[model samples]
Target: MATLNRRRFLALSGLSAMGAWLGTASVLAAERDAAGLLPRNLWTSPRFASSPFTVGVASGDPTPDGAVLWTRLAPQPLEFGSGMPPRPLLVHWEVAADPQMRQVVQHGASLAHPELGHAVHVELAGLLPARPYWYRFSVADHHSAVGMTRTLPAADAPVDLLRFAVAGCQHYEEGHFTAWRHIAEEPLDFVFHYGDYIYEGASQPGVRSMNGRPFTNLRNHVGEQTYTLDDYRRRYAQYKTDPDLQAAHAAAPWFVTFDDHEVDNNWAGAQDQDGTPSEVFLLRRAQAFQAYYENMPLRRSALPRNGHMQLYRRARFGRLMDLHVLDTRQYRSRQVPIADRTQVESPARSIVGAGQEQWLFDGLADRAPRWHTIAHQVSLGNYAREKDGVIVSSDDQWSGYLDSRRRLLEHIQRTGQGNVVTACGDAHRHYASDLVQDNRDSGIISSEFLATSITSGADGQGEDEFARNTLRHSPHLRAVTDKRGYVLCEVTDKHWIGDMKILDQVMQPGGTLSRWRRYAVEHGRPGLQEA
Candidate 1:
């Protein structure tokens, strides 16, 4: 499949591959036509008070020979409709082999429609494999900040090292995205954002206490809760406007997936936690999905259809690792209360749905790789807490889907699939544990590293009371810390190493950071060993 490009990947994926390919072809064709009509330096239309690249530029979902370049034309980002006219605008983009913008490899024009908030998603192909490229977009005299992106190595290439950062849960109101600032400076190939890019809620001022501590909200989301497409789009703009978050996006290519906060909190399938009817909830979901697709650096294959988006896909890092990005919230059953342990283990419950579950299992069973990294949203290992001497579990995570979790673990055990690691988000705390079927000391099948939130917890104390409770209760939990930060990981042929980078504070700007801990797993091992 050396000749395979982004278009052909869509063609070989699933039953909808043909339709997806045609849609991608149409987008590329439009880009080609616009490029033919207008030169990169021309087309100066005075349509804005300032430059339209307010949210900055990003690139994601890279292939061996291709990558998706993204930018939204939002001069007045917080305003409705992002301060753009109700018409389509043609934007020019270019990919260069160097940072100086010389030796241009691919350049084209993509029409940015107002319906999608004038966002440009250029699906570039036919470039050199396993290499870095500089990209930028231009509209008239407005030039976007240049972003760096890289394509994956050939599937059979012998890779020496792969470095990346895992991060998620950036609640806009709680604190600043200082962790993202630190991530922007890291020397890494890519960043895996495991969801919760934005929070959909009515903002409140002042302090809110959690774990017996007073935490303040320095910023807030504007307007009412996000339900309509315009609301969601504006919400995304609010988060994307942060300079730190934009720097992280501009730094490297990212692999992203959504958790609950991208839509409504604790939403399951078509059911909302606030008891909105399925039909109504699905309508809101459709709007949210459309806005998410518009603002994100994603390929057209992830375009929303009605209320659903096919976000579960794979990114290969040569023969070193195959990162399987999973979507758990979209197809989950309604969440049970944490106290209801019996019902939580019901056989009918599923978090990743049947089709996605099968797809992941089949991918793991296909062949042996040095690492099988499951880019999941929530914790896979059980994190039970001791409350009044009684152990209780969170219904929001894999603990609530015992049967489903068992199936995946069983597959690993049965296939002897070692070197399996789950890079997870949510829960707002850093956790590392072993995925064991029964006792913590017995039948250890895999390892999981749950990254803490980027800024969701607001100047959090280290290893707060809740984490202490969890560490005391769950023997499988190796480490737990309450901090605002991201996780850095480096993969070699023999050892997979990870470091938890914690920020000193996020309530204000220019916070300090430190590496909290480092862990490693050997190529033939399934459990984590402290480095």
Candidate 2:
């Protein structure tokens, strides 16, 4: 085989990301060994006394040609700055056709910079699409766990089936991540963790009562609510050390975006729940955004700069489905009181900002895919909870931004768009519902499947008064469960099926996993039906 020249090599690998630190635009091609990794002499490698790949490996933002490979070089992840020296280190990575990595396909070297918390995001762009590939990262003597990732099918190609999972809300102090273990074992094409990946609060202090039963926190956070870049980095490092979460990331490529808790609970735009000043909060928001990009399997395109990250992008699975991931918290207006019907119905309100709202409106009407799906944070339905014996609406959900919700739904109806299914988090409880215009009996428009948390809210005791009240009053709601788990969706040309995978407990290891609810939507049909 002919050796790859500088232009061909640059086109195949993402070595340019490290150009600032490495002081070079191209690397001379070096002879490879049977293992597909480069020879030690050709690359500058740092020898870590202890393994720095403590957070494991992950891949995400897959295009037709390639995906982003992510890992943070952290040996002591719990301490400040991940206990790493402030310096740049060369890291080698490779991809292979076989799991054993004997059939090496492409390989290259990149630098992990301390400015980005020693994180490496290798963005490869020349590989076969619609097929599975194995990848890993290495330093001088340490190698990360092998992760499996696949590219989406070519845009014009037809796909027969697509399987993926939706999961999020993993508060470290809540409970164990047993659900992630099961997710790792599932045969999935990709995973969407919609938000609240890390709870910003400090350690939980004592026992609490739920349903008159005494329970204590199963774990604890390291510090107070994350505010600084180091604090956010430490929080992410602690969460990434979980074996179950690591396994899930290695299982398949993922699509990740943050909700409010990544910065502060119930935060929207520049305002926080505690009424912190906008300028003060933007500093924290920027820090949190940087830490989020550093830890997750995300591309540099989503990198944080000046407190902003472009996270609302689109991906696809051939012509079978269009994957539209939305960012709801970053650009939303201040949340209004649910009791204030007048404020909730205001036309100026928005949960997905104006730009993202327009993008969603335009894409939903596109005729390329048979199925159109939206994965985001927060619920998107008219749900109400009981307050003072009166059924009051929820301000944390779309019900709070009634006019905004109406505009999107009306667009879907007007454009004659169908097969619109939304997978969302932040509710903590799992909900399967058929969305309608203002809960009208004849206003069937789309289907919504809300994923429960991985460990947040601990092992909940079934439905509570709030959930019961919401379900009873919300005419479109079909099912609600407080179990800790995720949603598994399988789609084809003619049908879309979502399974509500549940767990009995998360306070202890080896929680039992089961499934009782399955929501189905037929081709050309919009609303969901119990299947």
Candidate 3:
């Protein structure tokens, strides 16, 4: 059955698009009236005790014309209200052709309202396509770090080379974000963050390590699980303070989506894991969605409306690939235990519901790009294992909803849609598997490259027993690992290749990293073969 998330939220908002950010540009527009009078409560010459740009700058949701430039002015990064005054600040931004901002191309002013966490989202438009640009934010005497961003090629343009990285599941207290530093150094067009960006559970007590060595939280931070708007905002503020994460955001634009941890563990639609009433749970969800939009570089279109936020959208990288970012948590049926085999394939169960399923099917029918990268959040293959002498699949993954999985696969097989590649996370482990129907005999219809994590498992041991056994028993499964790293993807007109970048350790700084495995799928092929 479908969820009551959107319907209930829409009733509460009495509007759509959140209405908080949609009027931002208009407010800025009204700054100069007919008499050239400055707006009221606009902070122009305000000064801070210290630099407020400690969280750094970022850009995302790029288009051929422009992208969204993001930054929050927070001198006290850990405090509520961001420790800023209860007024709007007139922030100035610039886009230039050089790192030093010598050749200025675009410039504008935006209001960083206190109601919106004192964050600025400048959705720039009317720029040339397929080119690099540098941006920075300024207020009074303080300036944010110069971040590099680029516009994508036109949707109809042909592409020869496309490079990006898939990464997610970054638990802050578990370990350091060393891998983000590595990602910041890579020459990539963009990065796809498939979620678990923040862990919602409270931190552990103390002294959990091995080998007579002590592995402590990088910051030794202590906090409760996030529930209110301030809680989520504080959590994000803490995460954004990481220099490595800021570097990655400053390096390239990112396409991001949330998973269970962004709200609560294993949350499905209107239902929570604890069986809390949907009415009460949706209030917390509304707060979480609001917090997410404030911290990320999302467009005004993605603003939260009550409890719902529109995150399922697509972008085309020339004619090479079309990225369909999915929101698998907001509208789906409640998950049952793995033992409920009788309900696994029932028509009543839907992971994406009907509306999103149709949207996905229609996107697959498009004949434009050579590849369709379906960005997902959970294991989508048959991750079944022996349970009480019976094979049971995961309730949180696609295998638990066989009818939904079968419909997606059967659509691909029916339409002969080739060169489909999926990037999924939330498993905290790397998996390279072939996408087949619920019945394994239907053959491989697509390929999945599961990005492991940034530091979730705290220096995970490579090649776990599950990998060895699953690789042996499951023919559709190609490779598996427990390394704490991301996946690097390089696509050409003829083929697509993914390299699983492995980190030897993440509990300590300066851990060594390398490419441990490589897989390739040809332009028109469906299965992933080791390269």
lDDT for every model? 0.84, 0.84, 0.83
lDDT of 3 by residue, 430-509 (tens): 99988887665787798889899998878877887667766766668888888898999999998788999988988889
Model 1 TM-score, 2 decimals: 0.91
Q: Which stretches of candidate 1 lie over 4 Å from their true place?
A: 1-46, 439-442
Candidate 1 local Cα displacement, residue 85, angstroms: 0.3
Q: Please identify model 3 stretches exceeding 4 Å from their true place.
A: 1-31, 34-39, 208-218
lDDT of 2 by residue, 1-531 (tens): 224343433332345333323433245232122223332323254667899899999999999998988889999999997867776666878789999999977777775766678888888777898999999988877999999999999999999999999999998888899999999999999999999999898875898775467878887788877889999999999899999999999999999989988888899998898888899988888888888888888876687767899999899788999989999988888988787888888888888888999999888889888889988888887776667898887787888898889888888878775778888988888999988888344478888999999988889877777678778888789888788999999999988999999998899899999995998999778878777
Q: After superposition, how far is residue 248 of candidate 1 from its true place, in Å?
A: 0.6
Q: Estimate each model's TM-score.
A: 0.91, 0.92, 0.92
For model 2, state the Cα shift of residue 150 in Å.
Answer: 0.8
Return whichever of 1 and 3 wins on lDDT: 1
lDDT of 2: 0.84
Count of clashes, each model: 0, 0, 0
Note each model's CA RMSD in angstroms: 5.7, 5.5, 5.4
TM-score: the better of candidates 1 and 2:
2
| Candidate 2 vs candidate 3, lDDT winner | 2
